[model samples]
Target: MAGRVLRPVGVITETARRLSGANLHERIGLKAPPGELKRLADTFDGMLDRMENLVGAQRRFAANAAHELRTPLAVQRAAAEIGLAGDPPPEKVARIRTRLIGVADSSEHLIESLLLLAVSEEGLEHTSPVDLAALAATELAAAEPGAGPAGPPQDPTVVRGLAPLTVAGDGTLLGHLVRNLLANAVRHNRPGGRLELSTSADGVLRVSNTGPVIDPADVPRLLEPFRRSAERRHTAGEGAGLGLSIVASIARAHGARLAAEANPGPEGGLTVRVRFPLPEGPTPAPDSIRLPRN
Candidate 1:
């Protein structure tokens, strides 16, 4: 019979280590009375339960917020339409239209944030087979006119995906993620700055923009809710800063990796790289083949 010899971990009790796991060294192995050890274990379980409850509450709040905003936006938009049609002075109508636009924009932002949170929290409900290259092209096309370079437009760059290039994730959330990245780039860029977006076969999508340099220290903080750089805070059309955060959260939930870095340019700015999880195995057969024309 082989007798187990447990090495004493600093500040740990021999009995507790045996109880937790023979091969384990943990803070919970601290010397304590038998009753106290049981109490500590109980406390740990209680904390985990509390954490789960808190997460549930947050999800409910997101769902509720999304549900609540839809009605108000509809009502506000209708009222604005009526106001526009009626006999209001040009000056007054202009003011009214501007204020209404602000309201509508605010409401829309709120709804979008809530919906993004809800979809990410719910887990895989709104997902479908998505082509990152196609999505990026579509998103770029849909951006506001005069957003990027002017004159005769250049053709969009495309990266070939290995397979159906499909991943199971919410299409809306993904689109929002792409849109936010593009919008952020365009809004913060220097005049005539370059924007590049590409998707790879290895399940990575990258968006890069040329703009003023963001401080290295600001990268992590940039994703926090309502946190924006001082430079961007005063900028026109600045968002709540949930855009990148939402992208990060959704990436995490989908078991993907989200990375940020400074892009290479005369005036460096932020570049976001998101690596989505590839479905196990190779690209679909039809998608993988290069056909010969008849």
Candidate 2:
């Protein structure tokens, strides 16, 4: 058999193009400049880099979440096994029960953290307009540690906005956002420490507590999932390192902004300020939309 061999041909264009026609031969064509190929290659490279970072972040988040859950889960299982094996002394049983409660509480906390994260990631499409001042007040009331045996009065700093400023986002998630900030502040503060929260007319909310200064270097790192500063880890109470990360995620989801700084006041500590950009113009009252009451 006789065959004819043809050499490869080159084609170039100023811009990308695609052509379609009834005939199969003319159905498809794309035009591009010489450098377009290189530009495309660069774009592919950038996408790969972004994908790598996303995958790394996901792996790290999963590992850290597992580690955080394992401690409480292990304790809960052990406590259950002990109870099932035999009936211990009343005192011993009570201690085991107490330990089990702590484990259960930790589990609940983990679930709450996961829920908050999921909701924030889902974006604010489902959220209605929210009044930050009212939301903050409600969160503060619910976040109180409750009265001590002495019945010490608990007063949270409250700031009422000039008008009912509304933000388009999930109120429950925003409440969690506020609560997380307040909880972290209260939990990490010194004994008898002071907490102050303020809401500006421009939809900015600030929460500050008196405690040790957060090292400047650790500020950004603290916002990563499951990351806790060495100084923060020394403070009282069990923190799963999800606090500021949740705050950051919520802010991003809602197009809100968050700011943090070290307070120079005598009652020095880290201050976190979340500034929510007010929706343009008058905020129409949401019809039949309500946030979950804490």
Candidate 3:
């Protein structure tokens, strides 16, 4: 009787001791009658399942990050090598220099995005009141500094359907959320497509634009790090595929709801909506709080 009770405990202990990254697929999978020890073994198996999933996610993120960071570095190295080879002419040198600068700038943007994503994942330490409507209008109105010769001319027709809306969160992260939404919308749009955004006092911000057709099933995956939609690859000079993922992380940090849907029209596009929680209390009248005009 004593041996029978101790047998499962000993087995679980031994199995746990032998577990490692290479063996996450292994399970205790003990066969026993229903009781406290049986319950314990089942719980242990469940914990290992979660651990396996978490470890797998970290591994994937690391690989993707490495690959993304490597691309710009490789470009920089190749440009430098060409410049130094055989004493290049002044014009060629200048072009090489310019290319290097552009690659460096791209690297900087990627790093900044990675840092913001990291900060968002750690959760917010403090909170402040941020007006979603004003941020959307400001970002929508601002010129696209990223638009170089090869980039889009920000040509999409813009419509402002904003209302004064406020939510509690880090204002910077919230601003990035709006900026990224607008940028993603604009970058993937058609030449004469229409861009629209609206903010409601009820804590919802929505941006929609016209672009290439996308599968509805890919929407969720697009929110993951480095995931890009096949249809939306028209903008080759656009982003490192971190735009929507950062938005998703910031939304999670702020305890907000975020959704992206592919447009059903003939001209394909995406509509991303973020819903933040409104603070408890009556919202002040529009006249009471000064907001940015569209």
Best by TM-score: 3
What lDDT score belongs to each candidate, Candidate 1 first?
Answer: 0.66, 0.70, 0.86
lDDT digits (tens) for residues 1-294 of candidate 1: 122222223223443434332322233433444565456655654654565556665565565455446655776777678777668889978887777777677777766785676667666655567777787778877874453354325322323222335676777778888888877776666655567777777788888777777777788877654455553352236655566777777787777889998765467878888888877766568878888999
Model 2, residue 263: distance off in Å is 3.4
Write candidate 3's Cα lDDT for 134-197 as tens digits: 8777887773434545444547778779998988999899889889888888778887678889
lDDT, model 1: 0.66
Off by over 4 Å in 3: 1-13, 30-43, 143-154, 231-236, 282-294
In model 3, how large is the Cα lDDT of residue 264? Answer: 96
Badly placed stretches (over 4 Å) of model 2 are: 1-45, 80-87, 145-164, 231-236, 264-268, 282-294
**Distance (Å) between predicted and true CA of 292, model 3?**
46
Ranking by lDDT: 3, 2, 1
Tens digits of per-residue lDDT for model 2 on 212-260?
A: 7666667777788888755335222647888989999999898888888
Q: By lDDT, is 1 or 3 better?
A: 3
